[model samples]
Target: MGLGTGQGLHYETAERLSAALASRTICSVELVESLLGRARTIDGKLRAFIALDGADALRQAVESDRRRERGAALGPLDGVAVSIKDNMSVRRWPMSCGSRMLDGYVSPYDCHVVERLRAAGAIIFGRTNMDEFAMGSSTENSAFFGTANPWDLGRVPGGSSGGSACAVAAGLAPLALGTDTGGSVRQPAAFCAAVGLKPTYGRVSRYGVTAFASSLDQVGPMGRSVWDVAALLGAIAGLDRRDSTSSPLAVPDYTVALGRERRWKIAVPREVFSDGLDGDVRDGLRRAVDFFAGAGCEILDVSMPAMDISIGAYYITATAEAFSNLSRFDGIRYGHRSKVAGTVGEVYAKSRGEGFGAEVKRRIMLGAFVLSGGYHEAYYGRAQRARVHISNGFGEIFRNCDFIATPTAPTVPFPVGAKTQDPLAMYLSDIYTVSVNLVGLPAISVCCGFSPQGLPMGLQLIAKPFHEEELLAAAAFFERNHDFCRRHPKIDQ
Candidate 1:
């Protein structure tokens, strides 16, 4: 299929498109043009992107075509267009992070991830939308606008990586980048029926990516298929001198893990099927378990009591880190300066008061409270201990099982504004995802089944730290037997 037909080009997986580009059946310029054309025609409804640079993207695409013509293609992703989340620095591109605090701020240099993408010859095109400072569970907290779920316009697409997930789900880009601090990547991928992977915390560098929770923040890949996500992960996963937290271990070829035949030992945590889980989601998880068992993989019911306290511990730890990291956005520095400043104190107070959105402000305050002298030992200290406990709990389970399975979220996508009135209800949405971050393990969300309302539900598979190869292999094996990934939302043109 050609770009002119506007049929298969928009939804083709990055893996397939890469091969097509190498063979000269379709050029990188043509693929970018087709996707850009579709974004112009439909992005208004989904609000997936914050900005798009046609000239720059096409310029890079032309270079990719020239490379292929001269037999100098960089690698498999040389010409594929990858959408970037707004928080990652793209040198000269506005790095909004979905907040007004950095209103007109343009990145002065490329972050580590962007540098890696450039090295791989990938054409970076659009900057996707996100929650303000990556604080909220739904995209509703975004200062500019909320991104709609492509599966159902009235519902949310999950956050703070909702825009990236929506872009992949809506076919705006075959592959995109999303930062997962506390299920931001996997949650949205679940809601939108796309595949999202959260590599082990240090597996991907955080040098150029905007931070939410320093210890938990990780940049991950989102795509329609597991293989596409694997390809993107291979391109960006490696050590970066700029980020001390980045791992020094060698990056593996993730695609090689696909189609591996093995009798895997999988663990199903009993805590994940709690009372809060929606009925439809619970049923879907059971079906997934059955599939694994039928495929000759051994499934065991594992108990990890620490899972019960993950949400509380995560909020305390994540908010405290967020408070510290965001302190640098003062009016005296590079961010927004108060236009009606009378004194230095007033500038700092007024600028922050006017710049940050309500959600961002709430998290900042929560973080400060926990880190305060009076509450430091009571909250932050205890949270640190709890995080260690959770990590140890996962270690014990992994000793007997190769992987752990659970529902990505407790419920399917809720209508926009459904839980906005209750912050506690909204916080519970990440119940199943935060623990993985706290423990710094690799995890993935694949479309397992759909809800009665026709919305999608995700099956989350988590692995030991830096064992992304095994995680992707298990998810790919499951994906090959189902048609869920092949289904696309019907976007009105």
Candidate 2:
């Protein structure tokens, strides 16, 4: 159980692991082996990883260690094992996005984030599971298998980044990368007691990443602590010409913002605290508010009426984009093709029909309907207009407050089958998170407190676009005063 031991190395924060690697207290190979062994021992129950190439990972680790011995270390993240969500491409690795549609599809090149991680000397650990096409709020929609919450095995890990969140929470990886279009990173981090960051849209490039909702999707980082998330973010966030939507802003040293003292103005949206919120979650939010207040931070009540329609607007907009982006997967290219098909049209029809899971098909159909004649203006157009209004609302709020605070999710992690049959309830899981994505702002979820049922809850802090440094600082302040991140789930191996 000692910090110097191999068993303890797997659960250590990336920050500490980096230090260990730098000092040669332990080599990168030892760290990778420990994590691989841990995953081999417990991943059957959690189902966090879709695929793990231990040989490739070790090869990368050995290179990292050699770089350090030769005094050519890449950076602080060098030698760290970072898990990747299945949606992001890694050269020669399967990028299925937890869908049968992309079954056996391997990428020839690394995604933007993966490229950055390699430059920083981080090892690509494995591909974690997720909701098929990143369409579901819970990972139960994954075509392969559902990931379980590490806190309570019976409960579900929030998704479609559940596998990434579960891997970090269960001590399988020190840090992980996840794609958060609508709370994929934060909600699961909340449900699993970890830290997740959804950076400002365009802050990180989206090229080579499988698109779910093109306009909304952003590469995010998940880890056991705010510092860990900050370190990962520092590495992967920057301008990329490959993605037209990528911002040209310079990436800041995110770790520098941590541990800095600041009295920030935090806005609490009154609309987010509704009757739908679980009492335990509400209580946790209240405690978080009190903590900030006690820390001399100014807390104000703000109203965002657009939040009321964020879910609807998000679904319309995201689904429409998903439909357009997914059209390329018609089985003619490199994805899953139907073995039994007569005509080319039948190939397209049967391929999609057989390849896509229920949730993905539902979203695609919904997207098609909204984009269809006579309905585009009625649904998709209005959603676009609503998106503007929502962005304006956040702009107004930011005019007075530095950040917005809310519960990451209305409830703790639900049982695996609890809301699977009720899609509406499942969709509501991202209620507090979608608005940030809609506005293309930066937001983070840190473990605020635990529910009465012993489940973790998150306090989501959102900031203006490209203000990740400030947002991370505020979350780091809270994390420093709380012990939530230090606690780990006891998963029996």
Candidate 3:
């Protein structure tokens, strides 16, 4: 564990060392060997980690140098060193839902945020790529790998947590752990500038993740700021009696909700910037609404006709709950089984047609032809009444603006095989964060500007159900009045 003095760790933000590591002066094997040496020197150019535990991250930085020579009590992400996105799950590794029929499937346990980041001594240090099973947007449908876009590798890092937004946009994991069902960790941390979060829907703890549309999945935190996505969402949020949709509440102190009371009101949504939009994502949401109306708050101007049927109501409730949660990868109990089957429906259709991948067999044959039976009431009961009319149009625009800001994505990272044979033009590139994951509220994206082809451009914020500390203090007040983390994308420096 002698990377012990990796010198003044750059970009690390857990409120500047969670009280300077209580007294460890930066020794968690020097921040997990300087983030496993920038995830092994730029993860072969951003194909963001799918496994590289570096001897279990130097044996958990040598058990936090033996609990700091036996003083013990740590936890506030103790040795903090996050990163986990291979559709989540961490225990004996390989929880591959990026499908090759769960290529080397291994999980047996751990994943209530990997047991709260290994009981807050945090260091999962590996597994990233996503899409298959997590179902695309762009981690380029991950049959196994292909993340890129660490600020323009040929564009597109936005994704099914595009390798956890190119591992915290190529700083290579100062933080990570994404999920978001539709916006897949805030559209790959806004096409990879970084600072995601989706929470709210049962506020973090989907037991062991890996289910795509479980009433629109969650599990937030991606970073580079916004107090390191609210200190990795206050160390993986709470209440998980092993997640019966967790959320029993009382998990505040999200970095004390970012210097509280910068005062807010927000809500812009005139049907999400009507028209094709792409003049730098509409001048970066009109310069984040004129820097939040020159910082005195109050922006109002709502309306929501279910935002014109939220991308055909989120592709008919996420392909009818991804054809019933990918029908538990039928190849016997765990995953990958067919070595020429003798017919148990020919080993569940030839081990998921030879372990899926053709945009995951065309979204599992269009979600088994739209939930079969003569098209289950013309597509999953009309996308569950357009998810209660877009959850009452975000409950009537959070009742006149307590949050709503928009533009998490309209266009900016597309170019890696751009819209690969147009899957409904990449499912209308998640039409502005898929109706806040079909009504389970809470969003967040951040960055807020960029794109003249230099990519990057975010700004989402949202709120409502369980609010994620008022959507991370309204995206940390436009990441502190429009400085926007000093403009990222110059090949993620």
Per-candidate local distance difference test = 0.92, 0.91, 0.78
Poorest stretch of ten by lDDT in candidate 2: 1-10
- Give the alpha carbon lDDT tens digit for every residue of 1-493 in model 1: 4533537588899988998898888999999999888899889999999998999999999999999999999999999999999999998888899988998899999988889999999999799989898888888888999999999999999998999999999999999999999999999999999999999988889997888899999999999999999999999999987889889999989999798967899999998888999999999999999999999999999998998899999999999999999988887857799899999888988999999998888889999999998999999999999999999999999999999999999999999999888888899999999999999999999999998788999999999989999999999999999999989999873
Q: Highest lDDT, which number?
A: 1
Model 1 clash tally?
A: 0
Ranked by TM-score, the better of candidates 2 and 3 is 2
Indicate the residue-level lDDT of 434 in model 2. 94
Quality of model 3 by C-alpha lDDT:
0.78
TM-score of each: 0.98, 0.98, 0.38
lDDT of 2 by residue, 291-359 (tens): 999999999999999899999999999999989999998999889999999999999999999999888
Error of 3 at 155 (Å): 38
| Prediction RMSDs, each to the true structure | 1.3, 1.2, 18.4
User: In candidate 3, what residue range of length 10 has the lowest lDDT sum?
Assistant: 1-10
List the candidate numbers ranked by lDDT, top first.
1, 2, 3
TM-score of 3: 0.38
